[model samples]
Target chain A: MTEIPTTRRLDGHSALITGAGVGMGRSHALALAEAGAAIVVQDIVAETAEETAGLVRERGAKAHVMVCDISDVAAVNAGVEAARADLGPIDILVNNAGISGGMAKFDDIDEAYFDRVVAIHLKGTFFAAKAVLPDMRAKGWGRIVNVSSIDGMVGCPSSAHYCAAKAGVLGLAKAWAKEFAPWGITVNAVAPGYIDTPMMDGLLDDAGKAAHVAARIPLGRMGVAADLTAAIAFLVSEEAGFITGQTISPNGGEVIVGF
Target chain B: MTENSTNQPANSRFDGQVALITGSGKGMGRSHAETLAARGARIVVQDVDRAAAEETADSLRAAGGDPILAIADVSDVGAFAEAIRAVEAAAGRIDILVNNAGIAGGSPAMEEIDEANYDRMFDVHVKGAFFATKAVLPGMKARGGGKIVNIASVAAMGAVGSRAHYCAAKGAVLAMTKSWALEFAPWKINVNCVSPGWVMTPMVHAVTTAEWRKTHIDAEIPLGRYAEPWEVSALVAFLCSAEADFITGQTVSPNGGQVIVGI
Candidate 1:
């Protein structure tokens, strides 16, 4: 005799995901598509970006391709404007684009490499969010999810630049959450653990996966793309209206930090 | 790590799941029960008072939800655990637990605060939530996964005069939620906290006058009003949903931008 909710579909919403060509980004694109959101798949690579867009279109949702380097302010602004013209106002943004550079000690890493890492992870998120804020502010409703890493929550060994940029990204989201709450905008972050995505292709062989799963992860296996996407789908959905400025880590219980 | 419990259909977040919520006689707890019931969860409405609990059950029946009433005071650890066992015996298993039972105090000053009020605050808010969680953990661990959402207050992040005991108690809830998240992560149990700001509840209504409520609701809160109970219930429902599987050790505040603090 339970009365289920009438509907929880995102029939009228338009979303844009950065680096949606593959891995977690592509998975998120598909998940949102299933929920009935028109999608703008943004990736620097045109070929893969179009692939994700095609998948979105297959689900019967409108799909647009936005190809641009998110770190560059002018390029991101222009790209978003074009996407809005093709699709609609860019209200939902998922800053899922990031580069995990090779391991480098504090002294071994040079300034340019660090700056580049920061540019992609930290600056890329900042500029992309800046580009979409206009539509959200005007409409008085927006949802933004900054894709961080487990290393961001608990500093990992090596990759200092990646960790710093990822951690700083959360700071930016929290600042925006407080500043933009009046506009009905909610900004949050998702820090995934050792997820089995295209980014981890090199280390995801059967042997490596088994050894790592037994030694560290409490959940006994590496996470898949859907694990991260489920959280993102929830954050951007209307059901998550009250939550903001917080980070949810889907790391197979690898890193645990709380207040 | 467990990849969450697969994504559910758009219509039902619970559907066939059993949810046991404490302090469901009235206010936020009752609202949470109604929300989950509407979304297809079998609710175990736990409250100490039979009359109040039955009223909630009647409301649920009116809404087409058949809710089971479990009468037990959460402050009594032994009785509460037995009640939880009774629920497990009847409902197969409990998939979600919402610790929403708490008391209030509008005291004159800290100097006038009595030992009885201080102890009662800790007994209900802190111990009640803690032991109830303890009772459910064995079943949850054996079953491999579950969701636990503890209710906290925005006062934990800010100062409230003469309510230091309440704040301290709620603060402990937030702190232990982190530990539970870490401790129970391996079992696929996600423990999180929802620290609400001001909300339109019977508790708030009984304590404040119209002018006072208006002054705070209009001038203080950034959203220009206190949250409706359903708004708070929406968040609790989300955390219990499979979509929040990877989200452990996280504390979300639904305070209408009244208090914003970074983790």
Candidate 2:
């Protein structure tokens, strides 16, 4: 039998995870809740976020579900405040909601497609971080784990827009790492490869594309949500105070770039 | 030994794979070899020190596994060539490569870091891992698939007091992994890297005094303890397995709640 720690890693701390309806955002919410944090599950899909909140409640944790499109600034601010009013200060923020849209070669990318990707991922992350920054600064302790992608670090064939936005997340993390370090607000990101999730399923449904993408990774397999969860869990934990402005990749040995 | 055996599953994910681990004379490399061997992979124990490499090979033999010994300085060009040729002769195929051989030079400040230290660090980590991958890639392409895992450090993610060149070199390795992954993807070759935090290796223990370590490494990681080599080895083995097929162009961070860089 394995030993269990007496204290929950995030006990008494409240966490706000954007895109908490599905995919990585959902995983982060549940993982943080398991670690003893009250959760604010915010998503564009009201019912989906509520479903996630229901799961959290079943786990005997306090959860407030909010329906708000993270891409909208005013909505994000109000949602954050509602969460703070209900659960106390938001000590941890997980910016995991993102959209890959349709994959296309760089030359094929249209302005609308590119703009949407940026607005949801890049802009969404900025506004969410803005909303939580003051509260975290007041408390003098905060953790931000952004969800990026391996494509962000190294460019991809049809994922130029997605890659650029994710790369933006990294830049944002670095700048904030410096900006928030003084306030003890550590920010980092987790870049996953082709993780097996609803998002991946949709992308990989085309057999030709799936085959082409799968052959590129070194691990000879697709990533599971568990793989990413383990990495994020370590990052947002209190033990990760000194680990700011860093990008941790949990891809199966497919891209061997420097840390 | 004909076939090594341990508690890992048979028809194991690593079955039929030949894993070449650098610096297997001891520490993280040895742990990687032992674990991979247990998973039914043929092992290539490599190190700069001859006796140490052979000793590790002997240990694998005693453990009921087959391991070939290759003693050569990874920084030396001719030595790396010979090592690859030797593995081809022993194992008949190169299915996996783990670039774990490296040196952790002194704790001199960035300005005080001398040229000799910088060159040596890059030579072993950058040049060594580079050529080794270059030599093995052709064989992997011929075989239609393979895996490469480079051992990077959290230091590469940012400035960590000293070891500037080491950080830069590892960063290059990380970048190179991405390029190589894209280049070799058509051939079904996957290349990835592992960037660990302060793990309790002999080199680390030797370079860092107890007092210095207490204040630096121990105090930095959130877990408040150094990682065991086996912990990193588990991650390496998993990456080499079939389960990680879609994981290319990525770095796996196994630091104990430390090094929160972007994923």
Q: Write the per-residue lDDT of candidate 1 for residues A1-259, one digit (tens) a residue.
A: 2222323357778898999998899999998999888998999999999999999999999999999887888998898889899988878999999876565677777999898889988988999998889999999999999999878878878889888998998888788887888898988888888888767776457787788888877666788888889888878876667667767777766776654
lDDT score of residue A40 within candidate 2: 96
For candidate 1, what is the lDDT?
0.83
What candidate 2 keeps of the native contacts, as a fraction, is: 0.21
Candidate 2's residue-wise lDDT over B220-250, tens digit each? Answer: 6544457666667766776676645555666
Tell me the RMSD of model 1 versus the true structure. Answer: 3.8
Please provide, for model 2 over A1-259, each residue's C-alpha lDDT reduced to its tens digit, 9 standing for 90 to 100.
0111112267788898989898878887887887788999999998899999998888778999878888899999998888899999898888998987567788878899888899899999999999988889999888898898878888777778898999999888877876676677778887887777888777666675468556765445577786777667666764355456767676655556554
- Judge candidate 2 against the unseen true structure and give its global Cα lDDT, from 0 to 1: 0.77
Candidate 2 ranges with C-alpha deviation above 4 Å: A1-8, A104-114, A157-160, A201-206, A253-259, B1-103, B107-263
| Per-prediction TM-score | 0.91, 0.61
Top-DockQ structure, candidate number? 1
Docking class of 1: acceptable
